[model samples]
Target chain A: MDVRSRNHVTVTGRVGGPVVMLAHGFGCDQNMWRLVVPALERDFTVVLFDHVGSGNSELSAWSPERYSSMDGYAEDVLELCRELALGPVTFVGHSVSAMMGVLAAAREPEAFAGLVLLAPSACFIDDPDTGYRGGFSAADIDELLESLDANYLGWSGAMAPVIMGNPERPELGEELTNSFCRTDPGIARVFARVTFLSDNRRDLSQVRVPTLVAQCSSDAIAPPEVGEFIHAQIPGSRLTTLNATGHCPQLAAPEETAAAIAAFARAAG
Target chain B: MTCGTGGEEGGRERDNGSGPGEEEALFSALLEDSTEDLYEHAPCGFLSTLLDGRIAKANATLLDWLGYRRSDLVGRRHFSDLLTVGGRLYYETHFGPLLRMQGEVSGVALELKAADGSRLPVMVTSKVKTGIDGQPLLIRTTVFEARDRRAYETELLRARREADQERDRLKLLNATLQTTLLPPALANVPGLDVSAYYHIASADEVGGDFYDLFPLATGTWGLFLGDVCGKGATAAAVTSLARYTLRAAAVYDPDPAAVLANLNTVLNHEYNGDDPRFCTVVFGLLTPDADRGGFHIVLASGGHPPALMMRADGTADFLPTPGGQLIGVLPDAHIATATVHLAPGDTLLLYTDGLTEARTAAGGEDRYGDDALLAFIRDLAPSTASDTIGAVRVLLGTFGTGVDDDTAVLAVHVPRAGSEERH
Candidate 1:
């Protein structure tokens, strides 16, 4: 299997420099890290890719069985490192992908140098028994799935012309185009279930590499307390709160986010 | 795009004592209502939320539909708070990022929760209102009621699922029907090794290819292979009629030519309408020849492909029954006959034209012609009936998607004097 083609892996930056692989989460694709790629590539090698069934990756490689759990994506991360033959590279995972990094690094600790968990959460649903305030409740995740179903027709590329029917307003044709974040509704629903319903709180301690947990100042999805929870769980992991506010610090504060990653990568090396 | 700024600049003028122009009077009355009325009582709902989704302002149209007072939402609840839990998550994961990246999103169907706990389906279109320095200021939204469209979409999804299940059932029915048109297993003739195969070209439609072997009289067997013109239900009907007629005709007289002529007479009489149906068939009568220790065979053709004979002496060729016109077209059809002795270690194979007419190359005008099949069989001589059919099956499998029509093959082989084997 050509894992690179399956995951839409792209290698850019200094050829022999230390590699930093960036992984995007559920809704979008490789374009999530486009803002910070330029700054990271100047000094360190940057590897970017879309998860299977997202963005420019080959959609045919997406199977419900293979990608049902976090292990499927974790397995892809390890295969990519082996195929690229980048020795002990740094991995930066956003949102749900942060758990993927933890799962991957735990299985093959030798394949990674360090991990940067940006706006990550060990779990997204609230746990009453454990008294953990990860975030939303289980019923909320079900609601999210229903919302995806309701908008299924709107997500299809064939429906774009129908929805953007206003010719007088050019913005309807330009900005609202379903290009980068448009996922197949069926795939998006599965990913939504996987993202919100999964609990990896116990797996946080399994990450053996030096890790940096970066969270935004204010994110509705992953709040400050959730970030604190992730930081306390990972042993000897450093936690930093960026000045930006949103679930995506890479897009919100690209410069500071890139600087933090570069300093951490150099220290880990 | 501030709310209600469209066409609200009409000047209020006092009516003169004398009759003024009728058009001017009507135009003045329409615009005199003021922008506040247009914003508050418009048919569609409108809102302006801050960048962080806190609602700064909302029109009366939306607040009225949600059964909320103006103070309940303005400067208090976020735009997402108006959505159901699922819609809120959809907003965070998909809709928010899309708006931030693309600057606008339109016609996103979502359900809003009212204070009364009723779900109001609505279509939302939001745009980012940029400041003078190209900095994001706030989001302007327009919401339209979409109850009818939502109901239609739900019905569409249900109909689509039923259509999918209906197609699957049709395929199963077609497969079962196809089975009934052919014998489950060939008749186990004594002192003969026999093998047969049918390759269906489609799963959704029953094919017309059929073959059977049955006992005709004492110490004799009657067998036939044929293909009806066209396909599906109409051709399947003709195939069923042809198969039964051949069996009945052979029982009256065991002569191969006489059996085929009788079939032609019956088909011509039954289907002599404006749209006549026809088929190509070959009938053969097999009888044990005690003097030669083999079976004596007399075969008749009705515009069907010639049968292939692999002799025991390591040579193979087609038994050409030329001038065999198609059956059921004329009052008296011309049937062609040929005789061959099926000695020990010799094999005779019957087949339809699907094998010779199959395409051999992808997107190329190359077909698996008769010459290719002949060359293949020439090298396959001195083999038993089972081995011959097995090799032919392997050859057909190699063609892959190139074989586009239904095909059937039946082989009869006589084992060596000491073997007494079944193929």
Candidate 2:
């Protein structure tokens, strides 16, 4: 099968404009960028795709050995870029996808023009000796994994609203919950493990592309410290803190997220 | 009473005194009594937390379950303090953020650390209470005891783990049994180089492919490669019977065709009725020719793929042995024979159909047919026995999961003198 179709790539906006690829985080599909895509589509070509085993992407394309690490996911992104003939494109990644962007850009610097990382965290588990707080400890991650395994439906119902962080619009939370439930549970468990257990602190230094670290003000997933750390590690990278609260700035505060990405893209150009 | 309209009037007055007014008084009293009492002694625990997850209010039922007094929790500790270490971590990372974002979270499983150092399993549901201005004010949480549910979940997990272990054990047993069916190593012929390989597609089930190269007597060797009709225990039975019978038969009569004829008769007699088992096999008897400095090989085929012979002069082709019927199928079966002299630097290759029948492409529509094998052999002509088998192994690895059937290959070659030393 063609790599573009396998990843379910969808293109929109100016036909020959600078490409802007948007990648969603874990537990979400490309639809998560519905709010943010409209703002970027007018000036730049917007490329959106679901990760394999999520959304409309072919589940058969998901091999355990192939996608066992973040590197494998990065390979998929590079493959998509190569197949689409996208040259030095702006890559916008949210949450776990932020690390995916980093890994891809580091491997093939010529494939990326710039990177916009939304609420990115290089590591999740807290290291006492190193004093790096990714928020949860190892045991807490285990409990979360166990909870997911025990009743993924219940976990999705409980977590989706919290992750979306727009309590005023209960419908938004409901939609996110439905999306979470729609994901295959077996794939979700493996994805969850890969997301939480990954430590890409060493990989941050290798990013050669001009990057923007857009941190949410009160994100429980990736705190301000993590964003600062990423900004410091990447050479010639900018950091912008959005007033938006929660882990998902694109969902809760799309305008600010898009404005930051646009500003970074313009500055890079 | 006497001044009224006697007995009828008196009875109506008595009913009016107790009917509506008395019932209203009693219902009001019950409502007033239960309101505060119900909140304190409700079936589930109730608590309210500030935006920062600090305990602002807690009910008596929750306090009782954790062996904590109201004074100890309220204004003194955060809601996360009551949770176990792991639960606390989960609460801080997942639950806290979710409640803030979604405004509500339900049926979250957690364990609370009791005052006496015991753990209490609970299911928590929390909702954000918004003010009139649409701002989240505080979190209202309800905790339900989940002891029974937790126990059931634990038992289920244990059963699943046990089943996985049992499957692993069965796989180990099958692997050990499979190893016993094949020869440990091919017997080293005096003047020829020999090599063999067996590829197993799956470890869970035992495949019926078998091969053996053993010395029959002084200066003669009996070799065979075959695949049984099915897999698992049934095919394993046929494979064992065929291997032993071929060796015993070849010892009695050294001719390749006569040896296969004996095997056919034995299998047809043993499994002649319903549930008859069968196999496709190639049997070879080798004798050294002193004058040519090579071996004379006579091969008999029973519905097997034709053997490929790569000659010393950079040429490779199949030695045809046609019209052979599958062993153990009928009362009498045809066993085709072919005689070939393995001159110096010539290799004879015998393999089952698994290699040819493997899917060659991702779509799985095309098989690695006989023509592809023939082309491959022609390219690899003048190859040593070890080199040919090594190349086939590498080629099979490229097939990945597409090679669904077990494959066995046996090769014997007469090495060119003084070019390479024999091991």
Instruction: Identify the candidate with maximal TM-score.
Output: 1
In order of appearance, the predictions have TM-scores of 0.76, 0.63
Clashing pairs in 1: A143-B86
Q: Chain B, model 2, TM-score against the native?
A: 0.81
Residue-wise lDDT of candidate 2 within B1-423, one digit each (tens)? 321423566557656775676556556766776767898888999999887667999889999999998889998888877876556545644565455546777888888888999989988999989899987788899999999998887787778768879999989988998998899888988888999999998898899999999898899999999999989998898999999999999899988888888889989898978889889999999999988889999999999999999999999999999999898897688999999999989999999888999888645778999999999999999899989999999989988877888999999998888876465
Model 1: what TM-score?
0.76
The superposed Cα distance between candidate 1 and the true structure at residue A45, in angstroms, equals 4.0
Runs in model 1 with CA error above 4 Å?
Answer: A157-186, A243-246, A250-269, B1-20, B33-37, B69-71, B131-137, B175-203, B210-226, B233-276, B281-301, B305-322, B325-423
Candidate 1 residue-wise lDDT, B195-250, digit = tens: 98899888878899999999987899999999998889998998999999899888
Chain A TM-score across all models, in listed order: 0.91, 0.89
